[model samples]
Target: MSVIKVAIVGANGKVGRLLVSQLKNNNSFSTPLAIVRTQDQFNYFKNEAGVDASLTDIENSSVSEIAEAIKGYDAVVFSAGAGGKAVERIFTVDLDGCCKVVEACEKVGIKRFIVVSALKAEDREFWCNIKGLREYYIAKKAADREVRDSKLGYTILQPGSLELNKGTGLLQPLNKIEEKASNNYSINREDVASFIVQSLLHPDATVKKTISLVNGDEPIEKFIQSL
Candidate 1:
């Protein structure tokens, strides 16, 4: 089979960097198009991660401009985010930016799209109870809705709290979680990248599924296959 070509938005971010690294090292995926906003980011992926990239300011670009930037890739991953606590950025980066990505993918005819969302984003009660996280969750929720509504083959991964630790290669699909049981909510960024790679290489494993993830005892491949 031919290698899958991918375009990753926000390729300089924490998870984006990891995803670029993993995809480059793995044989299943081709060297991805690392989309970034600035020269520093383009250099970071080229020099540090050793991947090919393009410069496109997603927040400032139109949907058509973004679409042209990512054309010719087999798939796209929406991993961009606004790192600060800015309320306006939540809408711009998380909601509007992702919606633009969806539009770009649709225009370019790249049907395979993977989105990295946060856990409990679909839960209105969870958003209401969380302090100072409502806007972020709201943005994530809105973006996820747009991806699902689009006419594309998409997998929406809603991972729990993320940490910058080593991957365990183990995870728990939230659907398998026992009700009312205390679950470990933190997951390594590397593991999340691993799951995205697996989902990309094994479309049957996650196509059209919105899965919640957390660090658990089941091996990553096994858990994904089980889904």
Candidate 2:
């Protein structure tokens, strides 16, 4: 089988790191491109993770740099995010940065993209009136809109509050949970990573829709094989 090549834009992040590790271990992929921001991050993955991840700019790199990073990959994962509530950075990185990469991917003919977003984003009036994170989601919603129109094969995962638990691989896309039930149904980063990989490998799953991911007890490997 010809292994697919994928590029991870935010390769040093919690979710991004886990996905990077998974992609590295999978024989189905050509070595993935890991995009990083700082020297510290570049060194961390190079030394600690012991992966073939390459450093590229997610913060200050030119649009051409991003284009070059993903030029030959079969899929590109938009894991880059602007930390904290800084709404300005939200539009810049999460929205515009992603848009720039998508344009680059299109220019280079990379057809697959997986973007990680938040759940319950449409009802963000609660967060936007005050919280900075909520404002960030507003930008994500717009970015989602752009991906919908990109004519690219895309999978958007909208997980709730992220957790650090083990990856069971079962993703429960439940409807609005009761406020009290929201204790820790949050998903682990690994689960999200597995979903990213599965979405890329599966040909029948809906491409342009946003799917919610949450804690579940099913085996993810089984899910992937079934696909």
Per-model clash counts, in order, read 0, 0
TM-score of 2: 0.87
Whole-model alpha-carbon lDDT for candidate 1: 0.88
lDDT (tens digit, per residue) of candidate 1 on 61-131: 99999999999999999999998558999899989999999999999999999999998789898777678
Stretches of candidate 1 exceeding 4 Å from the true structure = 176-184
lDDT of each: 0.88, 0.77
Error of 1 at 101 (Å): 0.6
- Which residue pairs in model 1 clash with each other? none
Q: In model 2, state the lDDT of residue 137.
A: 78
